[model samples]
Target: FMNYVPDMQKNHFAKEPIMTPPSEVFVTQTIYADANGTFHFSLLKAGQWGFAALGIGEQKTYKGKALSQDAVIWVQATKLP
Candidate 1:
């Protein structure tokens, strides 16, 4: 089973992109970077998963920008390991 949150809102304008859980579990992480310089990270477990997107705009303007536009996300699962 999988739970997804589409069209999420941006919280703090300057927060690093990271995902945590209520408890630790085995997971596989995959990262994708587009030609536009945007990055997407996904975490997959046994039956649960989550994702984070980052837009490191311009590749030159790096001053006070949010590492992540959305709020920190957390996923929990028992079958992770």
Candidate 2:
């Protein structure tokens, strides 16, 4: 299970479709806010299903750094046949 916390203050866009099947499982990316209020994008899922959450404000930290300081976002996915 993957716990993905996002920043709500910042807009988030999924590269792939939200609802998908197990075989059609695809990877998606979530962009974070940049220094100028912009967002830096990235890829996720890779090819799987689980759950996630999204909100405003910086919640968790990663690699000795804060995930976000404006908002937070969460996402959840499931693999079906």
Runs in model 2 lying further than 4 Å from the true structure = 1-68
The residue pairs found clashing in candidate 1 are none
Please give the CA lDDT of all the candidate structures. 0.45, 0.45
lDDT of 2 by residue, 8-67 (tens): 667654445444535533333454554675554333444333323345555678798867
- By TM-score, the best candidate is 1
Query: Clash totals for all models, in order?
Result: 0, 21
Model 1 residue 75 CA deviation in Å: 11
RMSD of 2: 13.2
